[model samples]
Target: MVSVALPQIGTRLSASPTGLQWVVDAYVLVYAALLVPGGTLGDRLGRKRTYLAGVLIFGAGALTCALASNLPVLLAGRALQGVGPALLVPGSLTIVRSLFHDERRRAHAIGLWSTASGLAMAVGPALGGVIVAQWGWRTVFWINVPLAAVLATTAWYAVPDVPGTGRQSGERDGDARRTGLLADLDIPGAVLITAGLAASTYATVVGQSAGWGSAVFFVSTSITVLAVGLFVRRERRHREPLVDLNLFLRRDFLAANLAGLAVFFAFVGAIVYFSIYFQHVRHQGPIAAGLSVAAIGAAFAVAAPISGRLTHRFGPLPPLTGGLLLAAAAFLSLTPIGAHSGMVLIIARFVALGAGVGLALTPMTQIAVQAVPDGRAGMASAVHNALRQQGQVFGVAVLGAIVYAHQDYLTGFRIALLTSGLVLLAAAITTLLLPTRRPRPASGRSRHQ
Candidate 1:
């Protein structure tokens, strides 16, 4: 909804390109930073309770955004909204982990999750357009109000409560106590990663505006490096770390996350340019431009479940590799697209892109969680989501910078598509190297720990 209405927001707020980018990045920034702690917190508390709390926060944020009188107020509202997804996303996935015992069934459920997400993307633009056209941009935020209410109500009644495994019988007092809220929260680790990623995001945005060699960029980048370094060191030494760094030892886990990050990096980064091209270059209305991109969502919604089933049967490698290749092909197809390109060509490539995303995302989600012990499902889910969202921030910022640098929108669009294609291709090759077999537990941890 925010993506579709960004142009309107920019126009009304008299925003520069950098300000527009912040409208999107601000929400994603906080979401990515808080996800690890959010997931771990949910695991310590209860998934359903955490999830409902997130919904309420999201609803309140939406209300704040709808009522905002200025850009700063809007950004603050977006920041608040970010907190909801941090808690909501992993908690929802943890619920899936709780419900499905068999790996195959879990994969199928995750596929459904991907499909639903795709469907929302499909409908969002058109829905948002109608709301924006009728009631103005503020109404778009109001739409989330009813939706969140329904989600919260249904979830409370329908979703089962999953108890925390923070305390188990026959464990040493120290080990069992480590699972408690205080020990598991990993506050110092969370603070470091949050500051690091925030600095990194700020650096990218500032570098584009103020030049990469500017003092602000240099300072922010330095903070990013230092913060990230301290985060790694702290996680390695901390008991009950926010992210279990040891999980990366699993080939499947590492590859799937890397691949997922690449895929989102391409998708999110490229779409902002697509929106820009349609609105600025082609002079299309927001609704028309959004509808033009709907092909990807429609295709993804249809394909994701099938891909999930395939992953369940043949392992993640085949679908993941094939999907990346398909996405790369789609990106290449976009290279020739210009202000005068025909709708048919654009629609075809969008469908191809959507299919690729649908095919790959489910398996990536499946692998990230499956590689870990059931006890760590929430943390694993959060880590995957956080990386994926971080990839979006980088993708949008970097590609937007490329677009902003070029006077010609076509040149910038071409560069972004080509760059995204290269990334997808690289991910494809990486997918080929991922383990072909279903993951067994790493670290000798049993399912229940």
Candidate 2:
């Protein structure tokens, strides 16, 4: 929605390129930063309760954006919106994990979740464009109002409260209960990670305008380093870390997370620029431009379920590697596109891109969940989502820089496309290196032995 509305928002708000970038980055940065804490909160509180709260917060944020009168207000609203998804995304996944105890059944459920997500990805652009075209950019935010309301209502009525780490029947621990919610939040780690990522992203986004050698850049980079360093150290020493550093020791887990991050980094970078190419270079209307990219969403909706089923039967490697390679080819195919390129070629490439995303998302999500303890499902989901959001943040910022650097839009577009293809290729190679077999679950015998 934001993508198609970027041009209009810039025009209406009298925004420069940097301002437009903030419009996107502000939401993503905050979302990525808070995700871990959000998941942990769910693990302590009930997943359903937190999910509903998130829905309300998200709706309020959307309403704020819809009513915003200036750039500052809009950015604030976007930031607020970010907070909602940080809570909701992981909570939803946690609920799914609780509901589906059987591993195979859980994979299918995850596939359905992926399918819904892909459909949203497919539908959002076109829907956003139409809303923007008909009523203005404000209306796009308005659309989320009713949708959020309905979702909250449905979740409240239809969803059951899932037991958390120590909250199961006859299993409640008095020590954990006595500690209270504040102790479980890991405040220091949360603050450090958020501040570090925000500073780092601020430096990256402003580097083009402020010059990399500028004092502002130096100050920001220095803060980023100090904060992130402290964060890693704090998490390592904390009794209950925001992100368990030990998760990375598992080869398959690391690979899946890296693969997910790379895919989003490349795909988001390309898609953001795709909107720019259509409107600025090709002179297409917002609706037309959005409809052009709808192929990706449609393909994703179709392929995600099938991929999930395949992954359930055979493990993640084949689909993960093949899907990434396929997407890379799709990115490579875009190198030939220009202002005068036919719509058929553009649509075909987008469809292929969508297929790749659908195939990878489900398996990647399952891999992340499998790598963690059953008790930490919320945390696992948060890690998966947080990394992807971070990738999206960097992707948009970096690619936006690349696009603006060149004198001609076409040259910049080509470079961006080629870069995306190469990144996906690298992701494919990384996926290939993952262990072929699933790790055996730790057994009681291991403790005795």
Candidate 3:
């Protein structure tokens, strides 16, 4: 939705290419930064409470965006919007984890969740386009307000409250108070990671526009290294680290996260560039561009549920590897597209891209969650989502730089697609080579073991 509205935003707000990138990155950066904290909070507080609060915050952010008169205000609103998702995404997944105990049932439930997400992704662009065409880009933001309200109301009535860590049956509130919520949370670690990610993304996005030799890039690069270095050290030492460094020791967890990063990097970069190409290069209106991008979402919605079933019948390895390979092939196919390319070829590539993502996303998420103990489901979900969000940030920052640096949009587009294809290909190979672990039945054994 935001992708299709970007051109209109640029024109209306008098924004530069770099500013446009910030419009997207601002939301993703804040969302990625707070995900771990949000998940931890959900674990310590209540998942239901956190989820509802997030919805309210998200609605407020949407309202703010709809009313924004300047780029700064819009960016701020986008950042606020990020805050809401940070809390809600992990909370929702944790709820699902709690509800479904059986492995197959859980996988199928996750598939349904993914399907809902895919449908949203599918509808957002086309709907945003129609809204933007009819009422302007600002109207696109306005729609979220009503939807958020409905979701909050429905969830309050329908969703059950899941106890936070240490708050299970027969446990008293005193147990949770032993360490205190703030004491249990790694605030310093969160701050360090957030700062590191922001600095790194800033450097990446600004480097091409400001020149690599510029003081802004150099300083940001230094900060990035220093902050990330400090964050790693802090997480290693902290008792209740925002992210458990040990989770990476599990081969399945590591592979799933890496694959997640690669998949999102390619998917998000492609979406942004494709939207731009349809509108700016192909001279399509917002409605047409939205409809064009809808092919990806439509195919995704169709494939995600089926992938869940496949993952249940076979191991995650088959679908995960195949999906990545398919996405890579789609990226490679898209490399030759130009302003004059036929609609059939473009739509076909988009559909393939969508299907690959749908197939892989569910199993990837399942693998990550299953790798950890039930106690850490929220944390695991947060870690996976956080990495995915980081992938989005890097995708936009790096790929957008490539596109803008080249005078020819087509050349830049081709190069970006080729780079994405290679990245996916490498991820696919890595996933294939990693040890395969079938999801176990609901026996009392640890899946990680």
Summing lDDT over every window of 10 consecutive residues in candidate 3, give the lowest-scoring window. Answer: 440-449
lDDT of 1 by residue, 1-449 (tens): 78777778888888787788788778877888788888887777667778988998999889898998889999999999999989989999988988987766777789998898888878888778877887888888988998899999999889877755564555421133543546547788888988887888778767867887899999999999999999999999987787889989888888889998898899977876786788888999888877877788899999899997888778888888888899999998889788789888889889999999899999888889888876788899998998898788778778877777788879887988999999999998877657667644323332343
By lDDT, the candidates rank as: 3, 1, 2
On lDDT, the stronger of 2 and 3 is: 3
Clash counts for the predictions, in order: 0, 0, 0
lDDT of each: 0.83, 0.82, 0.84
Task: Write candidate 3's Cα lDDT for 212-322 as tens digits.
Answer: 789999999999999989988888888777778898998888889999999889888778788889889999877787788888988888888888878877879988999
Best candidate, lDDT-wise? 3
lDDT by residue (163-266, candidate 2, tens digit) is: 56646456432114555645566888888987887787777667757877899989988999999999999999999888888999888888889988898889
Q: Report the poorest 10 consecutive residues by lDDT, candidate 2.
A: 170-179
Worst 10 residues of 1 by lDDT: 440-449
Residue 121 in candidate 1, Cα distance off native in Å: 2.2
